[model samples]
Target chain A: MNTTGPDSPSRRELFRMIGSVAGGAAMYQAMSTLGFAAESTYRGPVDLSGAPRGASVLILGAGIAGMTAAYELRNAGYKVQVLEYNHRAGGRNWSLRGGDTYTELGGFTQQCEFDEGLYLNPGPWRIPYHHRGLLSYCKKLGVPLEAFVQVNYNAYLHSSKAFGGKPQRYREIKADYQGHVAELLAKATRQSALDAAVSREDREKLLESLRDWGALDADFRYGANLLASERRGYAKEPGGGLTARPLPSQPIGLTDVLDSGLWQGIPSGDRYDMQTALFQPVGGMGRIGEAFARELGPLIRYNAKVVDIRQDVHGVTATYEDLAAPGTKLQARADWCLCTIPLTVLAQIPMNVGAALHAAISAVPYSSAVKVGLQFKRRFWEEDEHIYGGISYTDLPITNIAYPNTGYHSAGKGVLLGAYIWGQNAMEFTAMPPALRVRKAVEYGSRIHPQYPAEFDNGIAVAWHRSPFTLGCYGMWSEAARAQHYDNLCQVDGRIALAGEHASFIGGWQEGAVTSALDAIGRLHQRAIARGKKA
Target chain B: MSIRHVTIRLALAVLGLSAAAAQADDASFMPIADLGQANGEQIYQHICQGCHMPGGEGASGAGFYPKLAGDPRLASWQYAAVTVLNGRNAMPPFGLPEDRISETRTVHLSDAQVAEVVNYIRSHFGNTYADTLTAADIAPLPHPR
Candidate 1:
């Protein structure tokens, strides 16, 4: 029964109206189905062609944002000097491996004991397809990339309270949930429960679509059948001769599936940022930073910690301590300064920026996060569980157990991301000694995989809060904080402008840093050219 | 909780009460307080190991997670307890024992848990502080800022 008249708008038209009524965000969300969202703003490389001769820019912090800026500015003929606090480049984009010892804020040194080739990318591990800016740089830098498996069908999804605390396979949960939801929707359509929502013509089409999508029977019921087994996996395999007969697997009922709450794990792979076609740099995520370091060479000054940042009408002078040398404070002068020091650290340092920018810097707080990389005696996850490279989530203190994306089907040892936790848990992990954290990770992990204790060899944990350079993980801006201070933070205050993940819309992402660097440089170049014209 | 959620909880509670399951493995849903095998270290391992990291050395990245091991900051137990209960800045207010975080039950820890975890951090990982704190020290603390 159709009740729509000529004036009645379609669903797309209705969402457009809602978008117009609500805002751009609402419109964006509404139009997401129409393929409107998720296009990277980076249009290849920045063309910084017209740079004034000998216009030097002092960049603080040799992080991705700073390096991106320096890499572009130097190519455009600007004299660039980057002061990095650490001996190595890539501030947060770091990878820890064997022989690397990290001494955090309070002087607790952690010596990484992972086998050769096995490393922990403590920051920025996965690169999304949509992050074209970083990806383009990767391609330009000749960094070899490989697929980062976002979802493994055979990975386990365990809840502390569900199914007698047993883990369910991703395929089993996804198949059962989809099959049940489809069956219910088909039933609703057949009973005309959705008469107002779907037209009669659409109803028949929807029913047909549900059957195909849900792997439902002709009667619209999902049960123990070959059709269901095709999506969920078969109990018995069909082969040649006597073993040719196949047995179908039984799907969990809708109630049980919903009650298990394992359904939460199903849609993570479907999210835009976490979708398929994700890539990780070959070897480790730090390869990109290392490549950037290789590209810049001596332009980057290592072991220089900026103690003070001051700017006059003429130029900006930053006083930095040579960590290797001690006692003496050296100064670097430039026409302009692009500081990428995290606000958490920058707030404490004396900088003569405007009150608004200073307030903006102090307003935004950084997140606390902890990650543990456990080296196992063998790749038991691959050998026993058949989970090649994906995340297995649990409610235990260790939030996720991410199997290594690389080294699939390789013999010998492997590393697993035992836990990647943030917020309160991070603070807690921040308090435990490094050895204790590894022991707890092993203990918590053994719940999901009983092989953890026996197979666990050595482990290292990184709590972002303890790092001397960066006291937290990343800038976590509240909506109110972003609304009030985001523009101020990003704005060029005199000869000083900030560029980092914190300066962009896409915070906590490497792309944000890259794009924000490009955007900051473009604006800074225009100002430089204007100043050059006046001179 | 909804009826379904209640049923799930009841099922979990039954599993929790099973003596056989408790005897079988530490993985079983035992109480957080019950699981502490003496020492502030074990308590810290059970509760604090998730985020503070396995090592009190603390994780490092874009920002600093001030190292608790050998940290001079724990000179005052009051400051430590307050930080745990009320949570500072980006840290969420937590310690509702057993992870039941709801509107009625907004906190994630008891006073004793806070003292134990805090003391654990102060004492372990090359730290030589001979200080101990109790639930009384933590009970009067304000909510995390």
Candidate 2:
């Protein structure tokens, strides 16, 4: 019980000491022990080789989950058909460009007006390296990949109430914060404050590491010096000839660094999901969905909205209204059904399932989110501020501005994600009309990028709650709800099963859809085989 | 002052009262916490009107938003209060803790605010319920764990 004594080292302090002595690899190992890092469970493709002959599966919603199931099931010798509500293959995996029009729930239509070769991906945009399932499909489908920058040191971290509303460069904040922390730790070690935590031999090594890692001087202090400038950038460049002298920039005070709250933005890229080597599809996020559609062209029936779903001892049937021809009903039947419809819409459909599954269906609620994409007359962020291919965060309602990761230093107009708003902010933005949402985004974003007023050409805003296909952005599963209902939601009730991002632990991600589909179909295939054997 | 100037000042004064209570004057940005909206009408306009529509007549396309204007459910203020405090189906709970709802930033309505909005909706929008509910009524309602 005397763990607070000097002899007992806290886990955090032990990890920090290990990170200081060893390198990133040891730090990653320590993090892994604490359950901070999670690797993808995808090991190659799904093995569905034993699908029973004449067995059929009717998939609902041609989103990532539906398409993935259809593709894999068909390849495994099962006859599969997919019904989609939207005319397009990708439901939320959508990209908007010039000539594309969208009509939301309120009957307001917006036509994207970005120039050629410029588009906005309003859905799942980036694919992490560990998301082997989605990445494997990208490779198999011939969708080229490009690096998506998650963090740019040259980008800005701003607080409206701090720094007199002036933006601070991310590199300065990061370097100064690390340097000051290192200096303080070194001071503690020199004073023998960490004597019980570290051995005498390790203490010398720790001070040396602090000097190197923190850019501390001979006296083990972090201040205005050329070494600190090397990490945080120099005020004056070291020119070639006569003006070769460099002026070091002063580090912000530790108090100011802590008060500004810019430290919150530093660890964004360090998260497992947003780490480095993140990638995007070449054209847009929708390209992966398009590739799936191209592969499963005839099997997918678009613009088919299912009104009723019923299952008997023999098979499953879905009655859908063909939107192209209003008031006409058509039925699709199969031996098995894998429904990937979002629960928000599925709750309204008449489906026969157990009370447990029905309660699970009605338990989870979706989140409200808004994203605004603005087209500017020029690449002003790169040209003016030297910020290329990263996000600038602010406390304003327009949460953050993300610059286009591709087409760096090109001529013509550029597009920026002007706002990525969530929660109450999203609801407020959703309350306004489409045009007004765009205007308000431009107005709030102007506080960060002053060039917005003059350079704004055209913009489009999407409130996920107002979007007809998905009532809200993504499924929000409370801890209690997930504990009580998650397994029930995933279980197969009679001849039907459900799979999507909503059913998986990784919500709001394509990887979730892919992995959940694979998991669901794996079970469905086994059931189909078992039924065939019995029959 | 000119008549136009006087009218503009009067309008701004009314707006300022709400803004001062919210502790933010920017028309475009609304803070998530401590909204400080005065009454039920203002709270509904600031929060509920987005999905429920301006007149409480909900819209449907991709998903259905149930109409609240002439709904028979408002007859029982307890039903409305419980639903608002603990969401059903696709609607998130407006009165729960932010962490409980899995949202980092969301509208967290106090008991008084919930009562106000509930009372306002019950009386207006074609519903004539003279019964009134108070914060005391809402405070006792069971919340989802």
Candidate 3:
């Protein structure tokens, strides 16, 4: 019952099942027929057929936004070049692994101590099933995708306030909440409490539906019985042969359940965006970036830190420094510009753009997020708790602990998202040293998984604000700021335009980056064609 | 600032570890037995160091923590002082809310410590600013609810 439905098959599982039986083309068609397909703003592959003759465009940052622009424009027969501060592609779409050293703005380098084949996606970790554009790119780039479990029945829902700080299985909370609601509603319906709203026949139907849906007994009570036990789980699971008999577990009272607030995490996976069939790259989220980089090949320039951006009626040019060498100025020029650098970092750079655009640039602020990746000696969550994959929600400062979705049931070391703090809690974590952050994460996570302190081998923590590349996590647009500047931020300013999560409605997501890039490039292409006609 | 530029900032992170090293030296002789009263890097290490880097580099991945190392934003000491003492957007107020401090234990900076850390960040971390914060400067600000 912790899951949204009875075995909501993942997109991958559904696709494979449909593909094997119905073929690839038939699977695509059956996907819709089966009513499991997600409808997105993306209408299949984008058509970029009419690029101007020999027009060139310069892109800033090799993040998903910039790379999406590059990947599409090059296919449309235009010359494209991308400038990135880091040596690799994918700005926020990054992953850290063994032997990888990260130097934050303040130059304290922490080399990732993760073991082989293990990695921590410090950036965009999960891809929603509805983010069609990103998913299409994953397919096109040959980046295999797998289901990212957002909820597991055995995973925990912990509240520090109630249950004496003990963690509760997600199934217990979800099943009990629905049971109480059903019992109350069924009782009300049977007693004519809904006489004004429903006909007697309809009330009888509603009562019957509630009993079945809530796993209620014939009398419509959700008590210690086999019917309720089927949903909430049994004390001793039914087995075959001699030990097949089952014992029903008592459901927690509604008052205790309400006060505990474990219900807060029960519906997390039920959200439209966080539903079943969620995905991640087969290896890590960073693989998508690396795949895009591979597709772009030599077109991307690494370690080019943009310091200034200038544009004239004819073309746009960016002045950058060779970050590898330090202080040496370099230049890259093109007829049009699509700057995907985060607003926080971009605001500090000088640019030749209109006042409106400048104001828009300075208007938005980026958010703060911190992630701690802790490597454990073994897959304890899977081995001991049977929580194969999914997240454990907690009221502790760590906020949430996410078990690895990949390498499930394997006899090997594993990495867990030990801490994912946001807002004020994130700031408190961000203020600490990396080692201390890791230590603190282990400390807090131990409450949910008592095996944490013993199993934790090494950990790496990334505080997004400390990154020199983007300077912040993602653009955060307040209602007041969006009202004044959201449109202005997206409008192509002269020959210069900006594209990134900051320039779109879906801020803080890669889908925003992908779609915003597509929109910006489409407009830029139109402008380029118009300029060609004039020329 | 958005939540991206959320937490403690290292005024001097990107430049080098010298700023953190210098602060470490200042706190080297302090009694480790009393972390609650420790000042300078000790306070920063125990409090702000989780989100901010040891050298004041705020953490980064998808979120942003403004670096304390010679950040151009630090030009306005009042802005810096207010951001830390009163807290900024997404950053919980570090002053007057004793419950908040009791909850986290890291942000429990005394009036004197708040002023001291601000002054330390401004003066160190590759910043050569002469103007520094004082307890008097912090004491005058109204405590946030």
Top-scoring candidate (DockQ): 2
Number of backbone clashes in candidate 1: 41
**Interface DockQ per candidate:** 0.14, 0.48, 0.12
What are the per-residue Cα lDDT tens digits for candidate 2 across A1-535? 1346555444345435534543422111011011123466788889998777788999999999999999999999988999999989988888998889999886789999999988889877788899899899999999999999888999888877778878899999989978887888889999999887778887888788788878999999999999999999999967888899999999999878777767666676877888888999987899999999999999999889899999999889999999999899999999999999999999999999999999999988887788899999999999999988988877777778899999999999999999887766777788778898898788778878889999999999998888888888888777778899999999999999999988888888888889899999999888988886322
Q: Scored by Cα lDDT, where does model 2 land?
A: 0.82
- How high is the DockQ of candidate 3? 0.12
- Model 1 residue A112 lDDT? 96
Compose the digit string of candidate 1's lDDT tens values, residues B20-101.
2432333312233344333455545544543365667655433444667767777877777777775554443454344333
Better of 1 and 2 by lDDT: 2
Give Cα-based local distance difference scores for all models.
Answer: 0.76, 0.82, 0.74
Kindly list the per-residue Cα lDDT of model 3 for residues A233-283, writing each as its tens digit: 998899999999999999998777766766666657765667788999987
Writing each residue's lDDT as its tens digit, candidate 1 over A1-535 gives 2336532333334334433443422101011011112445789889888899889899998899999999999999999999999989998899999889988765568899999999999877888898999999999999999999878888888776778878889899988988887787788789988777778787777788779878999899899999999989899977789889999987888777777767666765776777888999988999999999999999999988888899999889999888889867999999999999988778767899998998888766566677899999999999998899998877665767899998888888999999887534455566666787788788778878989889999999998766777776777665556788999999999999999987887777888889889999899899999997322
Which ranges of candidate 2 are over 4 A from the true structure? A1-38, A533-535, B1-24, B36-38, B98-105
Segments of candidate 1 deviating more than 4 angstroms = A1-39, A533-535, B1-145
Error of 2 at A294 (Å): 0.8
User: What does candidate 2's lDDT look like per residue over B1-145, in tens digits?
Assistant: 1243346546777776642223234443445444655467667765676778777888887468888888998888889999888877878887886445434234677788889999988887787888777889999997655
